[model samples]
Target: MRLSRRDALAALVAGGVGSLAGCGAPTARSSPSSREAAGDAAETPVGDHELATLVAVAEAVYPSEVEGVGEFVRTYTGSRVEGAGSYARGVAEAVGTLDDYAAEFHDIEYASLPASTRRETLEYMSVDDVAPDPDGTEAQRVRHYLVNELLYALYTSPTGASLAGLENPPGHPGGTRSYREGPDA
Candidate 1:
């Protein structure tokens, strides 16, 4: 049987993936208004090229059944990178590495490549085989900054959580009734 997105998400949630929810909520500083209030208006949140590449990565990594991939990636990644210091730098470096690799081999930007080709390029980079590490090898960094980041964003979102049969994701408050009822109720 073909595993649908819900099936995969449900399996992950059943396997204690909820613990990964410790990735935490976006801070106030991540908001554009807050950044402007803090006098950081001059700094760009995330580069266009980098964001585009990230969107492409999300498309390749996220389950095809997930809708609004572009918007979700932009909102999630943009907030995560804004005023994020070292994390933002890491994301930029990772996207650059992926894009450069694509260009060298495919003669085009990673974001411009077809979806299947993008997946193939990631496999060629061996991102799946590498452990996610910000300071490790090229493949590791890509896994950390691109692949893992997107997964984290998706699984933590309300829509994604519901796919796994979670009515409320961590950090999001369930209603008062939720406390009175079981998870399945």
Candidate 2:
């Protein structure tokens, strides 16, 4: 099923994906100073190019049935990058690596490629074969910063959890009444 932006935001909040200083809200668009004021000392301002590249990567990785991939990825990845300096650097490096590869083989940036081409580029890079590792080789870093990161964000959200048949994923209370009901209910 297609998830609206509102649904995605609600799911993110329920999953505690972007709870900065008890704000319990998505802060993708929050300024650097605001994020710091909220106690996110590690908050790194992700560049627009990086975010656009991430959205492109998400389009390749996420299932076609999933909607609002851009906003969801931006919100989730933005929050994740904010929480860790190393992670932000890794994401930037990974995007650069992907772009370099795309330019070499496809004569274009990764984000400029069509979705199918982007997926093909990822497959050609062997991202799936490599384990996610921030300090590992290029493929591993891409898996860590791009592939695994996106997958983790998607699966952790309520909308994405439902894709895996998890009606009540961890962190999502789903209400006390849900506990008394059967899985099918």
Candidate 3:
């Protein structure tokens, strides 16, 4: 099913992930393969609960677990190189560090809120009032950050790529450039 942001957040809260960092949600982003799972286990600094939260949010955004897409993003994020660290941090901060926002808007510890409340709060935040544009102001900055982070994280996902018809690496033996040859060519 298509999970709205509210739905995702609700799930997160329900899973007892009221941690300061927001790393306690259920997820559907399974390992692409045994090898990948092993690799992730070895590489990820975040614990399983946090990983699960990441996966849940990602799947909510993309919903393509069977295809190994969500796993790929999570694995890539764990590496913390190639700007992933900054990207992930910004995303967390945008979401009000998960805990801070939950405390302020939801009026409960991030972990204490009920699932329903989490979803409602998420819906409350996904609008212009909660996510305003950048204007050298803190609130606007947070809003802009959340909007950009969510968009970037989701749009760069495999499901997002599939939706846009962007061929994956393995699909093209040589590379994308080879397939991009125009009809004229």
Candidate 4:
């Protein structure tokens, strides 16, 4: 039967709504269930939430008394484009994945947990197996995507170099040529 333009529009909208109502929950989930599970999730923009998550993870991994993740993350993640997207995106995704894993295992978010839980969780990642290259371990994954990157940034900075007893590390030149004393000093 023929209908007026307004009637046709109304009928179309009703049909669309009816079809949507019958649909159930999605059959397939794209996101990884844990850090161990690899699944496709749409890339989200990196922001403070992600950065805070990374800072927590980094501190847990390194357990530094004098250093924090802020300067290291800001410097390395600033200009470089690496991992997942930019350096910032890589840090965000790694931390997000870790949080996903924590929620799946403990029914709680990573940052919300106590410091002990975070440490145990990261250690647990080390032995989680994909076989072949040992790098597949969750620890390694965390290290590669989070810790090592942060460490590299930290150890190369003037402060970190001094801590490591190096005079003018590779990336950080310090002030003048003589700014750094020998290891004996």
Candidate 5:
């Protein structure tokens, strides 16, 4: 289900998330796999609930418990060496918006909403593509940090190479270059 910016803003307003003073809401979301679950336990500066929100969003994007794509992204963001702090902060903020929306709308956290509803919420955000308020809203924040940026990081990184099934990813130290052969001759 797509929502135009106006519709999305109206929906968010109806949900009452727009009235929130700050992005401070508790949320419950599950890690995708044993590795991610383990990753989830490692602890980071980002709040546990906030991290869970990130993981939950990841699950929605990849939908694979074993792949742990989202968890991997989380790890990548943390270890990024330069901008990790900024990325983490942005995601934490977006998750706050999501949690607030969920709490006010369904009387449950966004992560706790039924899977279909969670997906719809994300779809709504993707389609709307605008913040509900002057300063900002969670939907736009989530799309920017979690959806677009996170996916870009995933698909463009060495980790994305694994997902794409490359024998030697773009910049490995000493791996064979297989793509030069081209499709079967």
Candidate 6:
């Protein structure tokens, strides 16, 4: 078949228009369900809604009390960067699972009980007086994540620096002055 010049140009325009239309749709990288988009925010094994709720609760409890808590968490969520560890998520999982710990002690969910009861439940759990159940995997996971090790690291981090008031140059004076000589020349 023979084609005219005007028809050829019209066909090329139609092809260009189709290509532009396809480009407007999202690519794999931009899809809502794409793994790239999910990253650490949605990578946890826990349910998405539950994880979000836990994150919110954690922010409330800690809330950049010192300064860098939120920034540190955001940085550490996935990379495991040397200084920025995933302590925030670990803490959230641990505290949110308080209900499981409560069940081990009082046979009830932590949130289901009165505030006083919840506090008491945590107190007992903290000291191991109630004996946490190793069989409950989630509860065990929570305890594992929220231990003294994590707390210690967080307290040492910049996020907790304000609480300790660790200044750049320590306020206390050195025992020996710069010009002080050996005690017994």
lDDT of 1 by residue, 75-116 (tens): 556655665455665676677778789999989989999999
Residue 51's C-alpha lDDT in candidate 1? 86
Error (Å) of candidate 3 at residue 56 is 4.4
C-alpha TM-score for every candidate: 0.71, 0.76, 0.40, 0.58, 0.54, 0.33
Top model number, TM-score: 2
Displacement of the residue 30 alpha carbon in candidate 5, Å? 29
Ranking under TM-score, best-scoring first? 2, 1, 4, 5, 3, 6
Clashing pairs in 2: none
Clashes of each: 0, 0, 2, 1, 0, 0
Q: In terms of TM-score, which candidate is stronger, 1 or 2?
A: 2
20-135 per-residue lDDT for model 3 (tens digits): 23221112322232323343333423444334444444444344432443454444333321222333333333333444666787675433556446445444545335545433
Candidates sorted on lDDT, descending: 2, 1, 4, 5, 3, 6
> Which segments of model 6 are wrong by more than 4 Å?
1-43, 47-97, 103-119, 127-143, 147-153, 167-185
Clash pairs (backbone) in predicted model 1: none
Model 6 lDDT, residue 141, Cα: 39
CA lDDT, candidate 4, residue 113? 67
How big is the RMSD of model 1? 9.0
User: Each candidate's lDDT (Cα)?
Assistant: 0.68, 0.72, 0.39, 0.49, 0.49, 0.36
**Model 5 regions more than 4 Å off:** 1-45, 63-66, 80-85, 126-137, 158-176
Lowest lDDT sum, 10 consecutive residues, model 1, at 26-35
After TM-score superposition, what is the CA distance of residue 68 in candidate 1 from its true location, in Å?
0.7
lDDT of 5 by residue, 108-170 (tens): 877677766876777765524564321244565577655654454444344344455643343
Candidate 4 lDDT tens digits, 15-78: 2423322122122323433431343333434455655665566567553554545544543433
